[model samples]
Target: MTAAVFGHDGPWTEEEYLALGETQQRVELFDGSLHVTPAPTPRHQRISRKLGNVLEAAAEAVRLELLEAVNVRLRPGRVPIPDLVITEQVDLDELIIEADAVRLVCEIISPSNAATDKVLKMHYYAAAGIEWYLLVEQETLTMHLYQRQGAHYVERSVTKAGAALELTEPVRATIRPEELLG
Candidate 1:
């Protein structure tokens, strides 16, 4: 309930982490450690919603599903709530979606979490064997797409505000960064 409850000396177990239940903040578990982040800004939410709508249409066409801010358990002791995830149809009643079911994960990168989204999460997602990663920059409205190769991910494409990004894999969708804001 309070910060003090999460300040113990030992590493947190997956059971213990999940037992905390949902809070207003975003909480993630990585290698027995918990990382709590503040809720996203309004601008970030706008981008997520618009982009999700686009992806949802594409996913439905391909029989895939697009989920927003869901718990994706990459592996034991590793769970991160991706901004948007395109996954194979999953049981609606399940509390968590496993890594194998995920096709692509997206994150809206704001100034406050630039390093975490661009670097830390990128590595973890790839390591979990998720095929694709999408990052949307909040300030410039730039979008970066990455594909996994071996143990890491390589940049597939980058689309700026005025440009449209054409995605061929996981699902087919054309997106323009500027359009996400409006």
Candidate 2:
């Protein structure tokens, strides 16, 4: 979740959180507590879209699919939405993408919630056994590709703007960071 889960009464169950349907705000559960935030900025949306487009072709060529802003259920109580996700094809009707079914989970950093993207969510993704986690820093136009090594993510590459990122795990894709900032 983007915001802290304190100053409230108690933690809310997953079912309780979902029942408060579609508030148009971004909502996630961290430590069984509800955290909500406003929608992303225009720059964030643009970057996410451009990055997804670059990854989409590679995903399609490999018979995988690219999904944007989809709920990824890491486990029973935690469901976080990443800006982009690449996964093996599954039925379209599935509500939340299971952690195992996901090959790669990507998050585009928002300035207001950078830690949640870089550290907090990264730990959760690694703990869920997610194989790949791609973190994009919008401010610097840098992408850090992390591969799951044993129980944690090991930094595989750090590509800067105008540089190309070559990925061999989770999927094969060459991404140019500059294209995402445009």
For every model shown, the clashing-pair count is 0, 0
Clash pairs, model 1 backbone: none
Q: How close is candidate 1 to the true structure, as a TM-score?
A: 0.96
Query: For model 2, how does the per-residue alpha-carbon lDDT over 63-146 read when each residue is reduced to its tens digit?
Result: 998998777889898988888899999777776888887899999888888989988999999999989999998888899999
In model 2, the runs with Cα more than 4 Å from the true position are 1-9
Could you give the C-alpha RMSD of every candidate to the true structure, in order shown?
Answer: 1.2, 3.1
List the global CA lDDT of all models.
0.93, 0.84
lDDT (C-alpha) at residue 137 in model 2: 89
Please give the lDDT score at residue 106 for candidate 2: 93
In candidate 1, what are the lDDT values of residues 26-130, reduced to their tens digit?
988888888888899999999999999999999999999999998899889999999999999999778789999999999999898899999999999999999
TM-score of each: 0.96, 0.91
